[model samples]
Target: MLTQTVFRSEDLPVADRFDAWCEIMGRVYAPMKMTSEFAADFRAHLRCIPLGEVTVYPTTFQQTTFRRTPRLIRQSDPEAYHLSVLLDGEGGTAWDGHEAAYRPLDLHIVSTSLPHETWSGRLPATIVGVEIPRAALPLPCGRADRAIGRQMSGREGVGALLTQFLTHVAADVGSYRPDDAPRLGTVLTDLVAALFAHNLAAEPLLPPEAHRRTLLLRIQRFIHHSLTEGDLTPSRVAAAMHLSRSYLHRLFQQEGITVAGYIRRLRLEAARRDLADPAQHCIPIHAIAARWGYPRAADFTRAFRATYGMPPIEYRRDGVRRQPC
Candidate 1:
């Protein structure tokens, strides 16, 4: 699952938010020469979710400046690439002898190991992205480095799909389970590869297995989104993808699970979350089970007990008992 941490300027004394933000940002991302007004009124909010090898950071803040100087690069080389998806306001960055302006939905790549200068104007700003490790991407260093500090249109084709996925993950990653982490990580990496290959017009250079895995990932995503629908069966999934039932079944072979088993397990996992959530104390276990597609309370209880010892009601009771005063 994606571990989450949130920091708000309001949490600390007005005089301390600036320095706090500077320190936190340095640790969450690579070290940068930071320059910003440390006024008492400055406001900032950061939310981080580390999903396996990929780390997602969503930030909104007041005017700020950041520089990745050669000295900082030599001091601590992270060797990671950041894909920044600007959600609001404006920003600009200069690197590798190039400078680019960015707006909402604009995607840009920043190399942590390389020197660059970036800044947000006096206006507030919001941005999100995945911090990808060097080994996660298939492209060689020299080839991938060409995209450093460059801007790409993130509103169409694979770019559009990639941005949508990032947005979803940012909003709902908390619902993910630990077992889902590695699978989601693979999907993130594949999407990054597809987006880069498309941008470089190097689709042919991508590994054959990666191309196939990407297709399966896309199919699984569709299934996940439609799981709540009563018709989220194999036939519906295949029809939605314009694929034959056999072909769709074959796709899940790579994951070592049948399509039906995958869907059932996901639903069960979701039901377990509701059972353990103190916030859902008022909701009945049967209702929660029905909500996740287990319409029959007896069957739901039976399956819940089989997967996790004890019944749903006991699980919820235990959750209540664990709450701190």
Candidate 2:
């Protein structure tokens, strides 16, 4: 059965909360006994549940002790990717001769089958965990394992998007419908893949078709946001995104055009829409041209004629004349 449980440390005595948490862990790692020596000062806010084929758990705690002591060996194969996001915490993990320290908004991925040890000192911490089948992720199996116990910061771009998505989901877990599980699972997979791709310097590893479509969508969004700026040139766009001007041009070339040509077409499209609107009939042609980044009326007129075989004034006049009563 699908189930969701929310717990607050203050709702129960500290000892009771600790015991309950251990029980939850037991269920999560069924047939494997789990134990913890929670600090007397421990406190937490947590939610756990099984949604469809995925298990989502979120925890916020302070001054906690965590250890899988006398580590019980699994009698069967354990295959799952445990993705964790540290919302607020100071901690580190030791495994396979590697150690990683984590701070706020950092993500960590670890495998359940791994022999690992983690410790969070006196600092308070919050984390969101997503447990999914290894097959759910679209990447080489060993790729994520390499990043395990390492910190992935959420300070910019795609990282920021993933961080925000996790934060929103954690804050509103109750509002999500059971039917949305598959879609949510896919989103989680995509976000994880994107993060790994960024980490590995292997953006090309992303399915080429999907990567191109995603890039185009991002470009379109960037262009739309800067439409009001007169100097929204390819160079400026490239610079804003830390891409080289030549690289930006190459991207536009994929669509069979140069960057400048694309910009011109988009501006002209906007100008055409404005001219066809009856509410803007009284606006001067030059004003419309300037609004769409044309600084000189003569230049705008020449370009409009070259593209549409007519000047802006005539186009607007003809368009209005063709309107039905």
Candidate 3:
């Protein structure tokens, strides 16, 4: 599991919880003034995951107002971009004379270098916040600043992918090893750079590696969504994504896999699960094969045998026999 630090207000004395939380906030972020009606007996939870220079915090807290004054910035500034993915509740942020309101699934950004204030409504909120160094992003300051204090959607395009990735990492930290943190952090940073570049219409400014990774993520998403279709081929995927067939092939090659092979692997994996599923036992093997893009039973059998060293029929029988009575 990825290493994580968790903080729960309930673990401390009722009167001390809020103050302790404020101390934590100062340690994790720049010092800020936090106020809430629930401060008397605040109930909140925080999980912090550090990925190298990037850190992810999934927090649940009561409605509170947070303000970072110019004095705080002068005292110390991380010079980082703070992104909040509002999983629940409504909130607003104001910075540098710009103000915007945000709802669930909306992406809100603020710079630690800029004095700002953010407040949630009467209800509690669940937020997945990410802190990325300003220098780590490839975009220029002027261009990237356009996104701060502006409302962005985390429901579509690269933003959606990023939101999903953050939530999955936060929720399934145990699925990852300790050494994976830095690599995971790198992926998070790359996605953030792509997201910011795309948001600012400055995709050309991204390094070749960042741009390629972004495109590869988009292609993979498209392929997974189109996996059930029989005509889901490299050419079709390229055309759908407005790229050439060769480029699509090259992208997959860079990942050390061929386009066709990747598609086949996904399909076979799907079929293998169905073949071993007790609920799907009555379904014909040919039908199951066709359902996952394989039209011919013989061809599916050959591919399945090559990949798993057994025919679909035998595999299903073995799975059934191994089941508890």
Candidate 4:
């Protein structure tokens, strides 16, 4: 399922707003309450989408107050995990006789079964939440819960990577494809687990498979940042990351993909983005391709057709013709 809904504060009346929220919250939480004051003028600029097997709701709260507690001893679906990434403001949680604080970019994972209270203060705030099945997470539930409400800075290591991933996904919500949801979900799960593992000082607690997966993620990030450079090759990527080319190749092989193939796919993805842009409608297809590393027009066309099922010119023309009136 790939259903999405967008809500803007300016679109609804103050009196009817709380009812709207209840409809949305009911889909995720079993029992929750909304205050009248919290509902009126508690502006929410948000979107919710069902991405594959998971559901993601990205919300920006404007100076509001609310609290949520589980309605049952156990969640209706024990198999699911609720992960929250704090984008702004301050909040706190008290669960299992433990209290913790949260700041911007901090991720909190709470079991659906836990009885916890979360409060966002008077300041405006934004959060992106993902609901994933328990089987999807590679970490133990006990250790994972221990990370809730603890601050994790988005400037270093896996925290930075996870922050970037969430930021990008939220920014480009309309561009994602049905096929990209599951893979994106996996990345979200892995990054959350990596961040939790780093915080617990329990690197050894993670399975070996997770360690290798995280390593490849770091490598992929490096490649994505350096994609525009002509020198961004296997050798350059290896040297920049201080890994041997053979080792890099082996890592990709484990994932059943090749380094060169990955590079090509990234390049094609970038080109597709440009082709669909109305601002770039006047730019020649060859120029767009060259900007993404395909220097020759013929080569760019061949690669674009092979990857996208159509030539660059046709894709761009179709994209422009479909613009809203």
Candidate whose lDDT is highest: 3
Ranking by lDDT: 3, 1, 4, 2
Residue-wise lDDT of candidate 4 within 83-148, one digit each (tens)? 777888755555676555566776766666567655554466788887877667688877777676
Instruction: Indicate whether candidate 1 or candidate 4 has the larger lDDT.
Output: 1
Runs off by more than 4 Å, candidate 2: 1-3, 29-41, 49-51, 68-73, 202-325
lDDT per residue for candidate 1 within 145-242, as digits (tens), equals 77665457679988788888888888887688867776777887788878787777733343455446446655755665676786688898889989
Model 3, CA-based lDDT: 0.86
- C-alpha root-mean-square deviation, candidate 1: 17.5
Ranking by TM-score: 3, 1, 4, 2
| Candidate lDDT values, in order | 0.78, 0.69, 0.86, 0.72
Per-residue lDDT over 67-90 for candidate 3, one digit per residue giving the tens place of the 0 to 100 score:
999998999999889998999987
Error of 4 at 134 (Å): 1.9
The 10 consecutive residues of candidate 4 with the worst lDDT sum are 29-38
- Looking at candidate 1, the ten consecutive residues that score lowest on lDDT are 202-211
Q: What is the lDDT of candidate 4?
A: 0.72
